[model samples]
Target: MSSLLEITWTDPVTSRKGYVVIDTLVRGLASGGLRLRDGCTLDEVRGLAQGMTRKESLVYDPADRYLPLGGGKGGIDIDPGDPEAPEVLRRFLAAVRPIVKEQWNTGEDFGLRQETLDKVAADLGLASTVEAVFAILPDADAARQRLAEAFAVNVDGLCLADLVGGYGVAQACLVTAERMGLDHERVTAVVQGFGSIGGAVARYLAAAGVRVIAVADRDGLIRNDAGLDVELLLGARDGLGVIDRAVLRPGDRTGPREAWLDVPCDLLVPAAMSYVITEADTSRITARVVVEGANMPTLPEAEAALVTRGIPVVPDFLANVMTNAWWWWIVFGDIEPTAASSYSKIDSTMRRLVEAVSVEADRTGRTLRACALQLARRNAEAVTERAGVTG
Candidate 1:
């Protein structure tokens, strides 16, 4: 389906490009994130926006008070580390302020951080990054407070907000392991991109008794045959998810990022950038299962190759649905702001969603992504019908 709306904005000072794509809208509101990266493009944002549409639809629950919003995404082509990047983002947001105030509800994604986005948005006099959806809420102030409380939550020093998505990713891996008849305790995993998602996934998987043997970051790959200390590594990470090599222990070893594919593990998680795994790269995957922690980490041909090799993949949209769902759930009062409430909701919902896709894949003999997209489209149709919407 074609996007409902698309906009391109160029920063006057930096001549940097930015984009916004509203893939679809159930009501008046659309939800997604704004990302800042050196080479972001209209097409990438468009694809991500469409993914957001399926992501929103995938989490639809008739019994819950939260109705999923439509999908939208924003991207700017400026390196996050650039000295003038802040001003570039400010101008881009200003250029899109009208749409942001009314239709586009966004937070942070990829190269952008929530605190930075919130600070910029606040300086622009926007009530919040998600101010667009306030009008639809029964109690906007209450919802804001609830979400704030939720964001402030932590378990073992990790913020609940940062961990929810990774929790969902970990759940997918655990379930897939079970389906493949692998012992969770004996499972070994390698994770790429030690950012928020990858770090949290490693933490949760390690806590679940899965030995995380290798982790890759911007600096390179860190490996430990006996499993690196995930908690220590997490604490050593900076804002950009780069681990401090000073924290390395006796058993830990470091190598180039390419070595990530060489680590013998039962699960491989690409949690960093999009299109990191090409068709040829699939040949290097030794994992029995691949769980996407990042959006569009695997190319079409790579995914097909993995499928041909009898590897099961937990598609990104389904695997990473919890963070988006969790936000709306809190905003719409379907869930409390507590970590317990968030974890419980995400865990149960992810399990059911993953199981549904798995069952459908078995019945139809389709890849998990194909089956998941089928379920999402069906739900999107149901949501549209219930909303009395027609395109």
Candidate 2:
């Protein structure tokens, strides 16, 4: 059965409606983020909440069992780019702060940042303001530190791998190459997003000797078989993650956005928005491996088609959960973070997760998705039992 969920809120200050979706809760606690986007829907928030709960349970050692931590997600349907959007968000939080303090812990997500979270906490006059802000804000410094600590214990000294989801994608590509008995050094990669996450992955792959041949962002796509300069391209990128078109020669660009998928490469990393790889574009993907850096970048049908073509995909939730886990531990446990500690934790968790899924899939002759789901379910069950919850 699907989990029971709830949504409620109202912003008297901005008159915006805020929706919080709680998928499950254990011991009166649930964790998730507040996403502000132009068209975020309640249904979308619900799905995200469920994903968080599963991810949290999986990474925190389900065998220790605890009632579900209850996953909750909140969002406001407004473009955060607007000048007054922050005020709108503040009002929204003010309306929901009472409920949030009691049960639903919210954090930063899409279009939300640490500064915004801090502002909201200050508006409410909370003590240990930074700590309180971190409690409900995703990826806050405190959250990151906690994650670093957990990851440090998990992997011991390999901090480079856990920087972000993009690093995870790079690791996945490495794992895929090793499994296929291909030369990792010769592999070429195409990244669909040039944001921090995507850029990090590209840089990591380049540093590791893989050729990153193509990169595309909201502005347009740039291709160079000779390999584009990661540092140069990053210099041209704006705060919104769009690459500046003026930096590239006209001939180096392509049109119609979707042309990015047609570029030939050994690996494709979709680090942009969700559902970018649809059924129509699935057949055009020439990459040997598709590692998602964003949540649900490929629809179920597209994933199935790719699998049918014998292409291996690392599931988004599995590949990207390390970041979520890191933040959760940071805020919940009050840990201090260092760059070395954070990177090591991300690297170890990603490596073990990719290797485990690969081994399970090979042993059972099942898809990576199937193996991942089975593992997630098993972990969830163990955690539930440890929490002494049965139904």
How high a TM-score does candidate 2 get?
A: 0.83
Worst 10 residues of 1 by lDDT: 382-391
Clash counts for the predictions, in order: 0, 18
Please write out the lDDT profile of model 1 over residues 205-313, one tens digit for every residue: 9999999999999999999989889999999999999999999998999999888987879999999888899998888888999999998888888998999999878
How would you encode candidate 2's per-residue C-alpha lDDT over 43-138 as one tens digit per residue? 777777777776665565532211236566788877778787888887777776765776676655666664467667777864322243344454
Write out the backbone clash pairs for model 1: none
* TM-score per candidate: 0.98, 0.83
Candidate 2 residue-wise lDDT at 73: 74
lDDT per model vs. reference: 0.90, 0.69
